[model samples]
Target: MYSSGPKLYHVHNCDTRQILEDYFSGNQEMVFEEDFLKFPIRNCVTTFKLGHIKGDILIDLSISSMIHHLYAACEFFKHIIVLKVNDRCILELKRWVDTRTGAFHWGHVTKLHAEIDEKSYEFQDKEGKVRSAMQHVVKCNLEKENMTEPIDLPPADCIISAWLLDVICKDKDDYIKYLRKFLKLLKPGGHLILVGSLEVTYFKIHKEKFHCFTYDEKFVREVLVGEGFKIDNCNVSRRTVESDLIDHKGVIFIAAHKE
Candidate 1:
C-alpha cells in the first residue's frame, strides 16, 4: 500500500490505483468468477439506444473522462459534441486517444455499444483494419474569461459532465442553477453521464486549494435530480493499473436519464 503524512494531504500522483487496491478496498463488491469490472452488467451501465433518432446529441462534458466515455460512445454514435470545461483533462484525453489509436475492440464493446447502432462494429480499426467515417472531438467553452459560472447550453440526447462540477462551493446556490443549465443541454428522455471522484479532490494552485466540487456523488445527485434527471445507475470504482501501484476512489460515474 501507500503511506502519507498530513503534510502530504494525498498519498499519490495521478497513478494511484495500484497502491489503493490494498488500502481503500472500502466496501467494493466483487461478485464474479473472474474480475467483474470487465463485465457490463456487473459495472451497472444502462442499455439504451444512443444513435441519432433524427435529433440525438451526445455531450461529453468532463473533458478528461470523455476519453474513455467517448471511446465507449464512438462505438455507437457519430457526430458527438464535447465540452471543454477543463483543458487539462481534455488535452490529456486527446493524448490518450492519439496514443491508443483505434485500440478499442468492436466485438468486445459491441454487446454494449451496439444498442445505439447496429453498425457499431463497423466503426472499428480493429483486426489491423481502419474505417474512414470519422467522429468529431473538440472543445466547448461553456464559460471563459472572468466568469465564474458558464452560460446555458441547448438540449441534446446524452450529456457527460466530466470534472465540470468539482469546483463549485457547497454554498454556491449558483451551483444548482448552473447544473440546470447543464441538464437543459439534454433533450427530454436523453441520457447524461457525470464522472469524477465523489470524495475530496485537491489541486495545487499558487498554493493548494480544495476543488470542493471537482466530482462527487451527493453533489451530482442533488443537481441532476433537481434538474430533472432520473438516476439509472450509480457506479463508484477505480480503474486499477496494478503496475501503477495506486488506487483512487475519486473517479465516480453517474449515468442518468432526463425526465
Candidate 2:
C-alpha cells in the first residue's frame, strides 16, 4: 500500500542539514560508502569534465540543494533551471543561493567534489560556478500533464533527476509516466542523468515513513530504452551499511541520451 504520510520534501518532514550530514557526508549507516562517497561525486564530475555532455540549458528535477550534481552541471551548462516539488524546497535552496543566514551549508559536498577532481582547494570556485549558472527555481508536479505548469520553460539540453522518481512514484507504471514527463522537458537528443535507489520500497525522514517504488537495474534500463533513450553509462553500487534509516540494497546511476 502507498504511504499516507507527509511528503518527504515538506519542510517539517525534511531536514536539509541533517540529510547532508547523514547521507551526503558519508555518515549515514544505511548508505553504502561508495554510493555516497564515490558514485555520485566522482562519476558525475569525471563525466562532465570529459566534455561529452556540454549544453546551454540544463534542467534539474530533484531536490533544490543537490550541490553534488550541480557542481558538475555548472561547469558545462550556462543556464540551469531547478524544478522543485514545493515551496519549502525552493525556499531552502533560495536561502543558500542568496547567502542568507541559517541556510544549509553544502561545504562538505563541495569539498568532496573538489577532492575527487584533484582540485582540493577549489570548493569556492565550484560554488560560484553553480550559483552563477543557476537561472531559476520553479515548482514542478510530476503527476501533472505539464510538469512545470504555469511556467512554460524552454526545452533543456540536459535533465538531472536524482533519487526522486522512486520516492514519488507509487508503481512501475507511474515511474515510467514520470520519466516520460521529464523527457518532455528535454530537447530531442538531450541527455537524461538519472539516479535511483535500487530495490528501495520505503525510507524515513525523522518519524515519518515515505514510500518508494522498488525495482532492479534491469527494469530501469528497460524502461528508459523503451522510452526511446539510448543508455550511455550505467553504474550500480551495492550497499555496505545497514540501518533502520532506509530499506534498499544498492543505488543505480544512468546517463542516457534521448534518441
Candidate 3:
C-alpha cells in the first residue's frame, strides 16, 4: 500500500484512467469490482423497473466514466444528458460512446446487466442503446447557479446520480446543498435514484485516498424527507466483499421522487 501520509486529492484533481482502472475496471488491478460495479448496476436495473422512473429525458451525474448504471436507463429514456465536472471525464465517456481506440471495455458490465435482466441474448444491443440515447456529455460546475450553464438543459424526467454525492460532498451540509441543486433540475414528480455506500469515509485510487462523506441510512432518509422528497424504495446491502482499498460498511440504494 502507498503511504497514507500525503493529503488526498479531490475528485477534480483525479486522473480519469487511474480512477476507472483502480475501481471500475474489469481486471486484476481492480479491488472494488464487486462493490462498485455489480452493486450499482444491479441496483439501478431494479430501481428503473418502476414505471414512473422512465421519461423523455434523463440526466446522469454518476462518478467517473460509469456507463454500467445507465444500461437499464437507456431503454426507458429517449435522451440522456451526462454532466461531468471535469473535461477528462467528459472525453473519457465520449471515447466509449464513439467506440474509439483504447477506450475502456465495458462488456463485462453489459453482460452482468444482461444476465440479471434475463436478456442474455441481446448483449450486442445494450451498448448501442446507451450510445444512441446519450447525446450530450456536457461540463458542469456544481457551485454555479446553473450547473449546466449556457446549455440550459431541459428539466429531466429523472436524474440518476450514482456515488457522486458521496465523493464530492465535503460534509452533511454540502450533501444537502447538492441535493437541493439536483432536485431543482427535475420536473414535477420526477424520480431521483441515488446509489452509494453507507458510512464510507474514503476510497483509494492506487495509493491516493479520496474523501467520501460518511453517513448512515437514518441520515439519508431524514434528509430526503426533509428536502421535500417522498421516499419510494430504499435497499441496503451489507458489505460482503472485504477489502482495504475502501472502508464502506454497506451499500445503499434509494429511489425517491420530488414532492
Candidate 4:
C-alpha cells in the first residue's frame, strides 16, 4: 500500500495502471469523465472544426497514458506525434497503440467521443483512425534543449498539451519556462491547445498523493499572451462533482495561435 503523504509525481513511482484506475476509469470515478475526458474532447472537436487549426503535423504532450484527448484530433490532422516525458507512459501508450494483450481498454471513452461529436454511426472506426494517425510515440526529456534529441523533429503545425504543464511545473516561473519550450517546437503561427486543471494543489492515485501546481485562468492567459500567443478561444467550466481524489476547483481549455 502507498503512504498518505503527498508525493512528488516525477520522483515517485507513478503507476500507470493505478493512474488509469483512479482517474480515467469511469467505473471508479465519474468526475474525471467530465473534467478530463468530456471537457477536453468537446473543446478539441469545437476547436478543430473552426477551420483554422488545420495542419499536417500535430504533436501531443499530455500528463498520462490517456489517448481519449486525441479522438477528435485524428480526423483533423494527418500525422499525430505523441511525446511522453517518461518511459512508463511511452510504453503504456504503445501498448494501446499496438493492441497488446491486457492493454487498458479505452472503448468507453471512444463511445463518449462518438456521442459528443455526433458520429455514433462511425464509432467502430474511431479507434482505428486514431491509431492510424498516431504514427510515433517518442520519449522526451524536458531538461534537454532538444526534447526529442538525436531525432530532430519537424516543426509541428499544432500542439495539444493536456494537464502536463500543471503536473510538471513547480511554480509560476517554471510554467512560463516550459511554455517557452513548447513554443519553440511549433512553426511560426502554429496553434496550441491547452487543457488544464485550475486551482488544484494535489491528487491521489491510490494511497499516495501527487503534487499538482495550482494556477488560475487569469495567470494562464497572461502567460500565453506574454509569450506571443493570440488567444482564439477560451473555455472554463466550474467543477460540479464532489470527490476526494482531486481537489480541483475548475477546468480550463484554451486554443491559441502563435503570432
Best prediction by TM-score: 4
Write the residue-wise lDDT of candidate 4 on 89-168 in tens digits: 88888999999998889998889988999989989999999999997999988988899998888899999998889888
Q: How many residue pairs clash in each candidate?
A: 21, 0, 0, 0
Segments of candidate 3 deviating more than 4 angstroms: 1-12
Stretches of candidate 2 off by over 4 Å are 1-18, 25-33
Query: What is the per-residue lDDT of model 2 for residues 31-70, given as tens digits with 9 covering 90 to 100?
Result: 5446755677777876788788978899988743566777
* Best-first order by TM-score: 4, 3, 2, 1
lDDT of candidate model 4 versus the reference = 0.87
State each model's CA lDDT, in order: 0.45, 0.78, 0.85, 0.87
Candidate 1 per-residue lDDT, tens place, 30-70, comes to 22111222322223224333333223456655423323234
- TM-score of decoy 2: 0.90
Instruction: Select the stronger candidate by TM-score from 1 and 2.
Output: 2
Q: Write down the worst ten-residue block by lDDT for model 3.
A: 1-10
TM-score of each: 0.53, 0.90, 0.94, 0.95
Q: Would you list the rank order by lDDT, best first?
A: 4, 3, 2, 1
